[model samples]
Target: MSFFNLFTQKSSSKISDKKLKEMLESSTPPLLIDVRTPEEYSRGHISKSKNIPVQNFEDSIKKMGLKLDSPIVVYCQSGMRASQASKILNKLGFEEIYNLGGIGNWSYGLKR
Candidate 1:
């Protein structure tokens, strides 16, 4: 399936950056993930976002000890990696996965 198709197939799997910002303010915040490389993440990232490079996402998620249904939002330098990561998360049984597209599309600012 196309990357966009994945989001369209599941209502909970794709969220705009603006919506993600709003969701971050909720009482129960979703887990924010940066699916870029460690170096890319170190340069800058959303505050409170965990860096889990897409190449090692599965193992990283396993090490995180999160529940299968935990709410999660993933982003990358561009949308491609994030979409791939989101699909991986879905296959891993994460029910509330949100592909927040690219960090470049995030207008709220970043934390270096």
Candidate 2:
């Protein structure tokens, strides 16, 4: 891997939309996070998602009092920010992190 790949690389788990939808409806839904700016998130975001911008990602996650093993789902307007947040989550020892990529790719209803 090149040196720059460290910054651009993504986490291992990239979930399919259908699987994510099912997870959302299941009894134990993952902790969903929107790594977009508050204003962009205000426009529209996935239901059950919390807005935690990538820059503040680690601090916000720490404040949430979540467990290290809790399942987490993260997304952004585009996949880039989500990837960044996912890396932070991994470094923070979160075990089940899933990057759902771009919100624009989501086929389900968004919360306004």
Candidate 3:
């Protein structure tokens, strides 16, 4: 890896399901993001999560008005899509980002 790649700060933070759940239960929850398609999101998603289809992530982020230091939790049906989205957000300068793996580990009930 290049010196920059090795020494540069990570684009996003990563958290496990348990830690994410705890944060969600706290008084203030992180900005939960579901990077799945609309159809997939409609099937079920974590409450309070904003659905931004992977295809439109770049476009959607522009309107979010979120700070780079804000904590963001991203997830998808199986984890692949969320992984890509996490990387994209990191590249865009979002600092505190967490890839919550997948919706499969969500202990809380779904919204839909």
Off by over 4 Å in 3: 1-7
Q: Write down the RMSD of candidate 3 (Cα, Å).
A: 3.0
lDDT of 2 by residue, 1-112 (tens): 4566556554549988899999989999999899999999999999888889998888889998998778899999889999998889877667789999999878987899
Instruction: Write one digit per residue (lDDT tens) for candidate 1, span 14-92.
Output: 7888899888999999999999998999999999898889999989898888997689999998799999898788766
Which of candidates 1 and 2 reaches a greater lDDT? 2
- Judged by lDDT against the true structure, how good is candidate 2? 0.87
Model 1, position 92: C-alpha lDDT score: 68
Residue 99 C-alpha lDDT in model 1: 87
Q: Which ten residues in a row have the lowest lDDT in candidate 1?
A: 4-13
Which regions of candidate 1 fall more than 4 Å away from where they truly are? 1-12
- TM-score, prediction 2: 0.87
lDDT of 2 at 64: 88
What would the TM-scores of all predictions be?
Answer: 0.86, 0.87, 0.86
